[model samples]
Target: MNRTPPSARTGNRRIRWPVVAGLSVVTAVITAVLGHQVPKSPSTSPTSAVPPQAPRGQHRDVPGEADGVVPDGVTVFDDAIPAVANLDPGLLKALRQAAKAAVNDGIEFGVNGGWRSAAYQNQLLRQAVATYGSEEEAARWVATAETSRHVSGDAVDIGRSDATAWLSEHGAGYGLCRIYRNEPWHYELRTDAIDHGCPRMYADPTQDPRMQQ
Candidate 1:
């Protein structure tokens, strides 16, 4: 009798296709879920990513507009220096208006000196004397605290030569006049100048009668 081989019968056995297909689908679903949960890098756009900067002249609230010295009870513009804050309100207003007009002609005005406390004026006078080697010589440049227009908040020392020249020519329109011929930077509100040109400048502060008093 010929015996059928048990190995030959099992050799033709087929794999279970349904089980494999089911396992493959489950694996794909698990992979998709993990991929979906993974964090992705954030995206940004030009408008959304950057912060805005403050425009010039809008930084009045910013610290230290000039030398970190703001006068008590005084407010100044961002474009202006601390010195402007110390000036008389009327004087500062006139200066700001003049500066605005000068800007249109490409001239930017600045204040090197304005109102000064009596103590500050005295300090300046002392420094001037040291530089010039005598009280008399210093007097020509700086006035005593008692007589200083700066202390009275009636004068301003404009910064920059371009601004000085512009004021010399057009300051009368704003009632601003250079008080000292030698110190062309010094200006005062001479309301009369608007109607009758700025009075002739004295040779220097020393030459003014007000200084004698």
Candidate 2:
């Protein structure tokens, strides 16, 4: 591709060779020393271990997928979640009233779990069995979908020690009673509790006659 005439080429070849060769040598040496022909740019974002959730109802159902899933920070006022929204009107009303009063004492009510679909309750029972290593042991913790108070929107699991403690002290007036001594967070609406005080706890769900159903 050299377009110069023979005479001109001969005249300039010697003068250009050293400079061109020197530049080439310098570039090769730099490339060798850097161990790359080009720099590798860093990624702005790295991939996460957990996959991202699909949008809304379009999401695929895994074992844990169910209507009563209450993520952290869901409160009694959060009607957007099916767990809180589908609660029994009487139970929901009592919880809301108690939550409103709790604010005056510097306590906010956070809902851990509430009204669960049948599938959700069954999932919980399976989880309980896995955790306890036996269905008999698990029965003390979780109930069948048909018998579960959560599936009927009659029970709720409140969050945080301080909030439960506040409820323990004052919940009876609102007809909110802890059903299980082992589960301080679990509460149910007992309209009679407002007048007669809370009935004896069942120790765990296993003692409750309703679980036999």
Candidate 3:
């Protein structure tokens, strides 16, 4: 048997230990790199996974109440002659009740107009003056901005001849009355009309005391 030299054996041992240490160090480095990368990759996923929330006060289903416009023939706002949102609260409530009653009776009450913005009222006055050829003549058709009940949100223009006719007979019970004989479409809240019945219709808006202002 040949005897091994101690120096040679020691040299071999030293070479093996270094290789093992090097491999261990490489493994630790790979693990550290992977650990650092793993944290960053998951960070983005959590943020992206969060669901979006709806905006506050956004009514996705109803457009009329949300926008306050209630285009012609769309009557989602409380069955008002149009949308009742801008009308006086009391007046709107009365109109809703009256409209509901009308609906039950097989008449679909509608509003062609209700509650005018000051700008809109002014625009109507201007248009009326242009058509009628004078401010005096316009007053008979459209009230001054300051005196218009439509601007005050206490008035509405009922739509459809049948709706108007139904109201002529039954509206007094709801405290609604036609103010102008010439414009049967125009109606106003007169709670007194509920008890005493609507005051006799004026021959026209010009004859209305409220419009005299």
Model 2 TM-score (2 dp): 0.70
Candidate 3 Cα misplacement greater than 4 A, ranges: 1-70, 76-83
Q: Global CA lDDT of candidate 2, please?
A: 0.91
**Candidate 1 or 2, higher lDDT?**
2
Worst 10 residues of 2 by lDDT: 59-68
Please, what are the lDDT tens digits per residue for candidate 3 over residues 61-177? 432433234466744155443336778888878777787888877877666777766666777788899999999888888887799887788888887888888889998998989
Tell me the tens digit of each residue's lDDT in model 2 across 175-208. 9999999999999999999999999999999899
On lDDT, the stronger of 1 and 3 is: 1
Deviation in Å, model 1, residue 69 alpha carbon: 6.3
lDDT of 1: 0.79
Best by lDDT: 2
Winner on TM-score (2 vs 3): 2
Clashing pairs in 2: none
Rank candidates by TM-score, best first. Answer: 2, 3, 1
Candidate 1 regions exceeding 4 Å error are 1-82
How close to the true structure is residue 178 of candidate 2, measured as C-alpha lDDT?
Answer: 97
Q: Order of all candidates by lDDT, from best down to worst?
A: 2, 1, 3
